[model samples]
Target chain A: MTLNRVMTVDDDRFDQLAYRRILKKTNAKIDLLPFQYATEALEYLKSPTRRPVDVILLDINMPRMDGFEFLEAAKTELENQIVIMVTTSMDPQDRSRAETFAPVRGYFSKPLTTDDISVIDRLVAQQ
Target chain B: MIDHDSNSRAHAPRSFAQSYATALATYVRDGNEENLSRAYDCARQALQSSISIGQLGELHFQAAQMLCSGSPSPSPETKRTEEFYLEAISVYDMALRGYGESVAQLTAEVLERKRAEQELRDVTYELARQRDSLDQKVKARTRELQAGLERSERLNSQLQQANQEQAQFTYAISHDLKSPINTIAMLLDIISVDHQEHLDSECLELIDAAQATASRMSRMITGILQYARLVGQEAEFETVSLDKLCRDVRDDLRQEITDGKAEIDISPLPDVRGMPSQLRSLLQNLLSNAIKFRDPGRPCRIAVSAAPKPRNCAAEITVSDTGIGIPEAYRTRIFSLFQRLHTYDEYSGSGIGLTLCQRIAGYHAGDIQVVSNEQGGSSFIVRLWINERERDNDTQSGDDG
Candidate 1:
């Protein structure tokens, strides 16, 4: 199965570039949609003409409408998509709390390694 | 005695017998055989009067017991001595019947005294048990009170810590986000400069200026976050060797020192209790400031020394620099956040170096003060309390914020 679309919600431009680079290295046929703010990502999801996203990489730390707030705002609309929380926070409580949301499937720390990318690849193949 | 009893003449016989018995005892005690015989004669005369059998028996019994008892002088085994013993035995036999009644009375008195003694012992035992129970109750009450006091103290400190953490979280949220903004601005500069041949020099210069401002803002933001975090961070306290801390700070700023031709002289320093990171940052800020504000004409000379504060037994660390000294009027203002005596071009800094140092000093329950040195330079003095209970008392008086 080929992955069609992936969206990233993050405030940091550097992290957004790094995540895209990691995915590009895998040569996966996935369209990347990046949002500099969680609110923008939520708005994009709410828009009528938006592409169907297969998976979302959500960041916990953001300027306005944090990743959790975004999830709360778009939980009903995100029923068909898988969400993977991405954060630089070392607090384990953040991951545990994110997992309680039905749409969230996994949590990964910052600077996603090759193994993390492989795990994501396998998970996408299963879907 | 006869005059007092003249009206009680019925008691005459008994009194006379008692007097004869006394005379017989006196003669026997003195070992006077002739007087003893005369006393026996007086007794026989008294017996002729009508004394009671009990009294007669008591009188004879005493005279007999005294005769039989050995005298001070040995009595020779003579016929007269044998006769005296015989007479004493005969009188003793007659007195036994009367003595039986007196024996019963004496036995009854002894039993009553024993019962009274047993009752006294039981009462004493009960009083002792009650005292022990009361003592236990008092001790239990004291333990409960102590536990309650400790719990309240713990809760109070926890509330204070929560308040501090809330304030820090707000400041860190805004300040920490600047790091990414700086990175993005630098990346923009790199992209523009790498393709300078395709772009105009005027545009490239503008990008460079933007990059420089972003980097400086990044440093300032970091400083702001660091200052704010000092309130909430529960950094572990350990024994810090001030001399070693100075050496480490010197190593970290080696490049700056070489660029400025600065010399750092650290004297023997005392060990104190404080967070290692905070103490290191405090020294780093002061040292970097000294180097940055150095007089360009001469080599920069910095001396780090320590002495004990007499009032609180805390170590007083003094970092003195032979550079442009701070003016007396601006000394207090320099320690405040973002308060700068010089412009960014004049002396490069985030303008929070002294503020960070002051915050770190406060974290250690200490204070930082600046004074003009005799060598015409600035001396930054930081006092740190030793690890002890007095630190808590001293820390409570000052506001960490």
Candidate 2:
């Protein structure tokens, strides 16, 4: 599938800034949508008037709704979108748990590098 | 009195018969009170001579017949003789009555004694049954206590396992914190490289300071993760040569040693039983600390030596350094986690090295003590067991971490 637009769900503002900067530096032809709360991200995915998101970068730890809770609450809305778990968790258990979700396609540590972006692009090409 | 052997008193019974007849004839002829009393005396004497009741009856019959034969018309005399015989026999009748009362009393005493014996047997049987019941109760209670102890032991083991898992979880969290700090440092680097021409020197210096602080925080987090990992994991033990281990540590810190103009003197040390990787970390931390905290006026000089405590099967290894010494008040506190004596501007460190060293020593069934040397330096004395048996003994005594 061709990459189009991406959404970021993270509680940390600096992490969002880092993502924006890295994505801008890469100059990839993709739209960026960022949400500080997983609840807001889930609502945006459910809205009919909202732009269709091709990829979702979900963080594990957040307020009100965690990444796993979001995956559960927006299961039907996220069927056409690929979810990539991006968080500051290096725990193998988190990776294994993310693998249980059908929408989750990849896992990466925080401050996604240029190399990580290329890997995501290649994952999209594979689909 | 009664005759003990009636058969041996046959001659005495014949004499008694003649005496009794004479007394009866006299009493009948005289009809006096004295003669009548004499007749009673003769019968009493015969009874006292151990004669049987049957022999006395024969003697009376013979006396009665003689009196009747002597008189032709002897009706009155015969009546008097019969009255005297009846009086004599009354004495025997009174004796028989007293003997019957004595026999009845003896029979009652024997029956009472038999009842008392039966009661004693019943009481003894009851006591034996109670004792057996008590023994069984005590045995059952002991078995219950043993089972309770075994259950508590199992719970204790499970609790220990849970605590280890919690420590592992803490380590993972600490490890995750490093990524964000790294990103901050990376972003600072990117800013400095990409936008240096647009920013002032002051802003660049501030960024540099922020980057430095972030790096220090990263190191401290790494130190915490290391300590947590050690707490959660168990290591395999092996025989370690201290002499070679010390040389290896010195080689690992070659750059720092050269920069500080440090000299390390190692003697022939003893072999100790411990985890090799942990021991290496222990020595590395000590040597690194010595180099980092050296006196500005003097070159760093460190000596590593060992002495065997044969009585305890232990080796006392000393690492003495000619560096800035620790104060007496902080000698014990230096081993606490995150306890620092100086700031990052003076000497940069995570402040967890000594704590790790102490933990490693405890893992080997040992302890570490610090003392100030005479030359204004510190000596770290570590006591480690020389063999596995000694270590096991120490561990059983609750000395290990």
Candidate 3:
């Protein structure tokens, strides 16, 4: 797939830093857009003049707005935005729940690794 | 004083009438008290013969006519005869009066008897009605008790569901707590790996310490999640062979066994009915602890054996090891969650292994206890209730293995 801009929504500062570091280490030719809250990410996606991203790396547990709530809002706001759940939660129920949403493409554990990035790249390519 | 002849003539009505005539004629001719007394005797005799009053009257009239037909002064004689007749009939009047009194008494008795019978019937009916009413009351009470039992059963089920939900909530919280620790450890690893050239040796050592602490916290959270998951889940029970299970656990801990050069001796074990995975976890934890707490000077010698306790339909499994024995004070506390007797530097563990073992034993309707061996070691005794049928099957298949 021709890689473009990718977005991340996470509440933890360290996890956000780890994701940036891991993505940078992967040496992927893609722009990174990070948000501290799912609500902010949903707002950005809903913006009229916002540049659309190819994939959204979403976190499940967050303050104020959770991943499921964001997915519910995004179903109507976006047409074909692929969301990949990268979360610290190892709960199978959360993974299954995220997969229930139409836009969700894949689920991964916390501290996104170079291998997980490759998996995401392949998922986006298939989509 | 009637003669025998007059008494015998009384048996015949015609003869009695002639005798009464003769007696009357004598009474009239002689005008004597003796003959008049005789005429009264004739009437008494007639009453004794059970003659009716009308028959006696006819006999008297005949006797009076006979006396009048032959007498010169018939009028006076006939008057006397009629007087005698009235006297004779007085005897019958007295008898009839006695009979009427008895008849009245009998009628009164009959009425009393009928009243008593009616009262008895009423009493019997009332008793029957009371019995039926009591039956209805008993049935209603039984229904009420049944309803109470059903309501209690429903409440008990709801309570069980609430407990399961609470366990699930605990599991969720533990899972959420684990993520941040894992993330922190990952971040520390990144720093230690990427910034090692620019950082001094002390800074790198501090990072290592931080990473170790984060790893320990992560392990603790994972342990809590596992314990909570055991409470929330309902696993199926099957026949589990402890001998095979021990071999599998040994294989799983092969790396640790090789590193410590631990000698594990497993005896033939009995089959029990339990959750296979939980039982495996329980044995694995015990084996892992035995290896982890081995004495530095001596070789680690671990032995596993089982014996049947027929009284309770259970098997007593003993896992004894030549390791650092627990003191008497901490023997009981070792089974409790997060109760550590050693520092992290001495022993690396989440301190939840024994707690998980205890929980798994409880799930199988069993219990586990620790005993300090006299030979400077520790032994864990687990009593697991086994199905009698499974035990029999195990006995039958004992020679096959």
Ranking 1 against 2 by lDDT, winner: 2
* Candidate 3 global CA lDDT score: 0.82
Local distance difference test, candidate 2: 0.82
| TM-score (C-alpha) between model 1 and the true structure | 0.43
Please give the lDDT score at residue B313 for candidate 2.
44
Which ranges in model 3 have alpha carbons more than 4 Å from their true place? A1-127, B1-108, B115-119, B163-168, B190-213, B232-239, B254-262, B271-273, B292-300, B308-315, B322-355, B362-378, B387-401
Write candidate 1's Cα lDDT for B1-401 as tens digits: 44555555677765664555555555545545675565455544554564554665666566555565664434542334444434544444445555676788778878888888888888898899899889999999999999999999999999898869775775767475786876778787777867878878877766775676677677877787777777667768999888898898899999999998999999988888889889999999999999998988777999999874445546888999989998876788788766565534355567678888888887787888999898789999887763455565755433322
What's the TM for model 2? 0.57
Off by over 4 Å in 2: A1-127, B1-130, B133-137, B197-206, B308-311, B338-348, B386-401
lDDT of 3 by residue, B127-229 (tens): 9999999999999999999999999999999999998988899888988898888889999999999989999998898798788879878888888888888
Each prediction's number of clashing residue pairs: 0, 1, 0
- Scored by TM-score, the top model is 2
lDDT (Cα, tens digit) per residue for candidate 2, span A1-127: 2556779998666578688878777665668999888889888877878887667899887644679989999999888678999988888999999999999999999889989988887787776
Q: What interface RMSD does each of the candidate structures achieve?
A: 13.1, 14.3, 14.5
